[model samples]
Target chain A: MKKAKGSVDEFTQAYMEYYSQVFSSILTKVGNAEDARDLCQEVFLIFFDKFEKIENKRAWLYGTLRNVVYRHYAKKDPGVDIDEVFNDVGLTFTNGFRDTRIIISEALEQIECGEDERTMLDLIATHNFTYGNAAGVLGLTRRQVEYKYGQLVKRILEYLNSKGIKDIAELL
Target chain B: MNTSVEQFHQLLGRYKLSRPVSPGDQEYIINSRKQDLKDLLRKKGKYSLILWIVIAIYAGIRKFGIHITMVQSKIIAGMTAVAVVSGSSTGVYQGTKYVIKAISKPPAKVEEKIDEPDSGMTIPDRRTTEEKTKEEKKKSADIKNQDLDATPLSDVPSL
Candidate 1:
């Protein structure tokens, strides 16, 4: 049998060298640590799946992370200002844990009646895991985390509209 | 832009307040990555070496099975050497041909820039001219009004 050209070890090494960079790339876009970490893992899983087809695995990892983050943002209100949360939370959280916690909390409050939603949101927000990180702890997709967060926001908006609340500040 | 700069600083402050990941966290991540790469390279090299060794062993087994004499073996070895040398020389010749061809070829030509036609004047100049004309018209209108006022009712034409 022909021996494989690249091994699991090689991929792992590449992942290590580039994992932080991938996380950094995702965080820069997603603006949350747990989400960035979750995306980081997803990037590796993608690397493992497409290992044979990829030429430069490191670049592939970064590109995949970037795409996932963009997809997350796109699913949300494209007009939603990421910079607002990022700036408000402050970049001081290099891991972006606090920011992610705060954003998730804000998003969760917007969402309506699902006991599971509150439980999951509490696990992530109060405990301070990123949507991505929470997904890992909860066994979900990074996309799922983003979607849930989005749903929460939508529910909150609906609730507010029903209550005649005017702005995001009202939720606060 | 100024506000973004201020906002960036504020974000940076919040980022610092979060729980620290610690030095060990970073090291663990980095070390695991290094080990993975080293293992991959090592595995690849070992596989390549084994392949070459297996081929050599197989060739030896076939050659001895043929019951070749010393003289025939020597001749075969000499011919193999000649073939290898000739093949290399042929490769060198082809490489040299490409090099020479590349060296002799002229670089691609770049087009010279041609000046474009100017529409009589630019926007700012046109605006200034328009303003100046309006000013001149105003001044003339003012002089006509002054004349009308200065000339008495005697100078005015009868109905």
Candidate 2:
């Protein structure tokens, strides 16, 4: 985290620390190693171009990464609307909690939300990002993201209760 | 509310989204980074050279006395100020482009039929050349007709 601070003389340090995580995030979103590699390179080039001006390097990188991935999807299938079609969390659940995950995933999928709402949920929940950082990545103010996340969780819990699945106390 | 949120996050922990970079991708990033940085550094060096050249030219003009001006001191000050600001603020990337154009042979111009796509496939020409030319001609003819119309307050004397 400390290495994410300065870009003046520590570009190499920043790159070494972030390159892998950025690649991984991109790979998960894009689902192709080759495309991910190219997109990751594009993100770095953009970072390089604006190296001097950007602060909160991690947030900015992730933000740019999300746009690049969305653009990649838009390019691949011109007919498909990117936000409408590719707005799922894309997180993989391990076999450990197969049934629970399946139920949860289904409930979340049933809810119709905007792209940023889903992205905010995904980043905060899976990546353990701070609300501020998640908000920054999605180009939302902190309050806006907090509100959206609250609404999202409320909707999910309501949906679950409606389906007669009160709570997964044992899983937690 | 907080407890519920905590429980939600814990549930989310069951799902995962991460992959450590493979050695191959890491190597590519490292190599490409080196090349990119080399280009950036070279551009920086070019900017430095530009600054030095400006300084040298200013010094030469001041010392030679042949480069006299209307107000020598003010002109010198103004020139130096402009030189410094321009040499600093044009950005290294643009400076590199202009410098490269200065040193390298210019490429032959080719008329492009299709504008390049932002990604993936070639861009299709949405409007035909004839359609574009027809619209342009209509615009010019309209302009000419507007100019030919005469209206004036001193109509009797002018007629």
Candidate 3:
């Protein structure tokens, strides 16, 4: 019983450490702060509830977070167009810049390639999420995140180069 | 390859929501022991629900008076527990679907048709267009009329 209690304590500490990162990821995806926080708590709750049943706690966590976010949106606004949320969050991001439209357009165009690459790019550049944390969040190893991030950055650069945008600074 | 580098740079500028949460904020979240308790209770409730559902199903099946061994009873209970959770999840999904469908209705725009009498039959397309135009024209005319009325007739000379 004492050993079980100790293990639970360890799980709780790990959960608290990852809470903010998980909350922010869900918030960005949902574009609503309150709902994101609630869902984040719900994720942790569900995590603890199934703690004994899961083998890879980290992977289960990421999977559960994904499912919770999906289920929340699915319930609140069925068929809520993801593109609209992206546009809204993307616009908020652009508005932070001095030259909102141009820089934003460039940023958006560059990031529009594919899911895994875009996600990797967002984690590294947008959120400043470390490769280690991002990899954990994505159920990947740090080495995998680093490897994929490099590939994604390479692909984005090629796209810009083809468009005659030689330097990233020029886009800015 | 090149596209990814550009994407990385662009994403850097797009980090609007990614601020480092203060230690105080982190502390608050960490200290919310009440929330943790509530969350635990909710899960406990769900598990209780599963247990009750299993009992209910077992009672129903056993109404037939087929005597089962202890091992058989455990297996039936386990299967019933799984069925209860699955049923609840399905209920949640279906309920959410209908709610979303109901809310997605955009408000109906009232448009008057000129080509066809404003009241009766016309293609669904033309009626909406007509109403929009009519509303615009009326709004413009109201603005112009207000402007003319605002200039007192006495200012034009007492004719």
Candidate 4:
């Protein structure tokens, strides 16, 4: 019993460390604070249930959160369109520098990228994850993540250049 | 910005900073985590109860002088297997029925037409081009009439 309690405490400690990061990630995806909170709770509960079997806790939490968010949207709308969600990714950005941000966001949206690539960008840009860390969370090799991110950046830059915005400083 | 890449990264960093989680939210999540842990433990307790009941039943049977024959043991195993198979089949049947019903149900506020030449195979046209043109023409006529009415008498020619 004492050993069980100790293990529970250890799990709780680890859960607390990533709770905010996980919650924010869900919040960004779902675009609702209340739903994000509920999903975050569900993710941790699942983590607790599978704690013994999970080798990589952070990665598992993230993957589970993704599943939870997908399930939530799927349940809310039976025919949820993923492309519609992707097109509205600009709404997920912060309010500061609204014009430039929207432009950059629209440019990113125009780029034909897979969901995995977009998720990798989110992990690196928003969650501040290192390439290796993002790769673990996304269940990808580090090299794959690096290549995808590089391609995403190149596309965004090309998009900006096509828009006659040669000086990146002008937009900033 | 020296480069677009640097500008992009800087903007993302600023966006990340702008979206910091509040202390209240953190606290709420912690409290919810504790509740979840308690609920998980309760579920574990339920499962442990079943295990304990099985153990107790086995112990009681062992203590009794009643020795089970091989035929009886085989019969019991056969019955258990049959029960499991029947239960799983029933579950699958019910699950498939529910999915089919859900898929067949029509969405709200949309009238389903039953006059198709092919009943089950015909895909309904969501919005016909003829209907769209008609609606557009009606809207344009309404706007033109409204504009004519809004024109002042002074602006009209004395004819």
Q: Arrange candidates by lDDT, highest first: which order?
A: 4, 2, 3, 1
User: What DockQ score does model 4 reach against the true complex?
Assistant: 0.04
If ranked by DockQ, best first, what sequence of candidates would result?
Answer: 2, 3, 4, 1
lDDT, model 3, position A27: 64
Q: Per-residue lDDT for A1-172 in model 1, tens only?
A: 3325344434433443355445544555565656656666666666765776799565566467656665677677777554543344333344536644355334445555453365344433333345554443233566676577556545654554455544433222
Between candidates 2 and 3, the one scoring higher on DockQ is 2
DockQ of each: 0.02, 0.06, 0.04, 0.04
Cα deviation of A120, candidate 3, in Å: 14
lDDT of 4 by residue, A9-60 (tens): 4564455346656876777678677888778878876777777778867678
Which model, 1 or 2, shows the larger DockQ?
2
Per DockQ, the best of the predicted structures is: 2
| Estimated TM-score for each candidate | 0.26, 0.34, 0.33, 0.34
lDDT of 2 by residue, B18-116 (tens): 233444544544344434434543544422343334333433443342333223434566687899888787777698998998889777799879866
DockQ-wise, the better of 3 and 4 is 3
C-alpha DockQ for predicted model 1 = 0.02
Model 2's TM-score against the true structure: 0.34
Candidate 4 segments whose C-alpha is farther than 4 A from its true place: A1-6, A81-172, B1-9, B13-159
Whole-model Cα lDDT per candidate? 0.50, 0.61, 0.57, 0.61
